[model samples]
Target: MPKPGKHINHKGRNRRFTNPEELEEERRKEEEAKRWRQKRGEVSSEEEEEEDDEASGGSDSEDESSDDEEGKKAKGVSNLIEIENPNRVQKKNKKLTTLTVDVPPEKPQLSRREREEIEKQRAQAHYQKLHAEGKTDQARADLARLAIIKQQREEAQKRREADKKAKEDAVKAKTAQTQKALGKK
Candidate 1:
């Protein structure tokens, strides 16, 4: 009993086992295709074997030929295309492994405490540098001291000028008094 709407062949089981002659014809067609490929310079093992046999001037035995034919049939159309092992190919267009000095290596995974310590050290160094330049708030006392020293220097300069003017005035007065006394005498 055949399934509904299914095509049945009362002669054979399925399309694969249909006609032995049809299978043989299909095998012949495959051989013809192989011959055409050979003409186009695509060589297979079977073709190579036939060439070797011809070169050696010896005929292959029936069993060996049949085995070779069976092997070719087993390989089928899949073997027609040449496939290269991807690993075997050295790709010129592949992205190059560039070793650049500019790119820093990955930092080692540090603990939170260690990272914070490093950050603190860097900040301390930065602040210390700024403090040395009198740029940080911590250097305000030093700046104030500098300002005081400058003010003191300016006061000392003024005092020196005043003392110099007084000495000059006294000398002028004494000279004028002596001249007047000499004239009067």
Candidate 2:
């Protein structure tokens, strides 16, 4: 595949735009953009050119009628009025990108140390949340390991007690036999 030509530069070296489907795709995208602008009550470049023509004092009957209709349309809808429906799922409203200038930032209300402490707490919470996700499985494994170790220790303790008891009983028996042998009889 050859590279697409960048405007007038490298013309013969490129051949990607030669496909009919690519040209149609580009054309369709442009048409869709024009439709979107019109739906948003925006005047496209073509409309702008027509407006310029009317401003130049074109005596066309259709242009004059449209101008009169535009004035009537403006009077029908107030600029201060808006339809606010919080439940409606729609695209973002097209309005001026306004930002509040008088709103104070957190920097004025909070000290630097306080802000840092809050950030540290937030970071700790996030870390704890991530650790908790894997902690359940790790805790189960640790408990199983501790149970095995405890059982082993208990078994060893029992074995030591049994050996001690056997030694004590054997010594008692040997002493009894020795005492009997030392008797006057």
Candidate 3:
């Protein structure tokens, strides 16, 4: 093969890359070095320190105001205790009389769709039970009535859809004619 084409070694060039796992390890070491550089008081900005101080100061002010209010309330309760009669302490220790307010039972509310579904389920179960009890004639009659009702509902729905579509078509035609007359189409 013509002296191995000048004996050039491609494997020696790839030795720098060696294994795929070594590449991953090198990447992890780079990330760890960057994190340590950041931790050595070299990465945090002054604006971030200012934001931290502002947040801490806001919470401290809120806590001081709450402590002052609590102290004032405690002083007021102490004054009240000093002004009260000592002989009536037993009466004060007794629980205060509470008035019980009677409330009326709330009426349960059901949506129209929920009520319809519940009624439909109850009717289906009743019909199935009747059929299972060998009431074949009654079951057949109920099924026929249900079929008639379903057909009537489907016919009404179709009529409504047709009417709506016709209305929409008429509006679209009118708009198109107007646009054509205006020379905008």
Candidate 4:
């Protein structure tokens, strides 16, 4: 804030603003003893110390001694203080090991022809594997079962043929009997 310029009255006398409370306090003190105790500041403690040193004409040794004695640090300045360029990124150490694996790319979608080919290959491979493991080899019990199934199929076919032949013979015999009756009439 800008300090107020020195005020000049019509009487050419300089005037300065003073606190009424302070004036009253001074008056009370003067009334008590006609005296007692006095006043102080804009310069900080550090600046004040520097001014004191300049005023005292003190030696370097005395300055050093004062510095050693006045080791009291300002409260919590360390926490508030920040290092320069805190937002700057730091370079990483190259010596550290890094793992990079080259994974296989995703399998492409197969077309209809390709899918059919793959299915055929899988069936052939499975058939070969079953034969190689002797799993496709028919056991004696399985052979007997197959033979019984064949025998049953053959018997059924023979029965169907016999029934068809019997139907044809009946049809032929009925036609012949009808022709003979017509001839007699």
Please report, in order, the local distance difference test score of every candidate based on alpha carbons.
Answer: 0.79, 0.73, 0.72, 0.70
Q: Which stretches of candidate 1 lie over 4 Å from their true place?
A: 1-104, 107-121, 132-135
Candidate RMSDs in Å, in order, are 18.8, 19.9, 35.8, 19.9
Q: lDDT, candidate 3, residue 153?
A: 100
Best by TM-score: 1
lDDT per residue for candidate 4 within 52-111, as digits (tens), equals: 566676666467646744663445576478657879998977643474457687899999
lDDT of 4: 0.70
Instruction: Give the worst 10-residue stretch by lDDT in candidate 4.
Output: 34-43
- Candidate 2: tens digits of C-alpha lDDT, residues 1-185: 45667446566684655689888999899768766876776654456456556576666746665664565324345655876889988887655557666777675578889999999999988767765664656656877898999999999999999999999999998888888899833
Error of 3 at 103 (Å): 58
The reply for model 2, stretches above 4 Å from the true place, is: 1-135
Q: List the residue pairs that clash in candidate 3.
A: none
Candidate 3 ranges with C-alpha deviation above 4 Å: 1-128, 132-135
Q: What RMSD does model 1 have?
A: 18.8
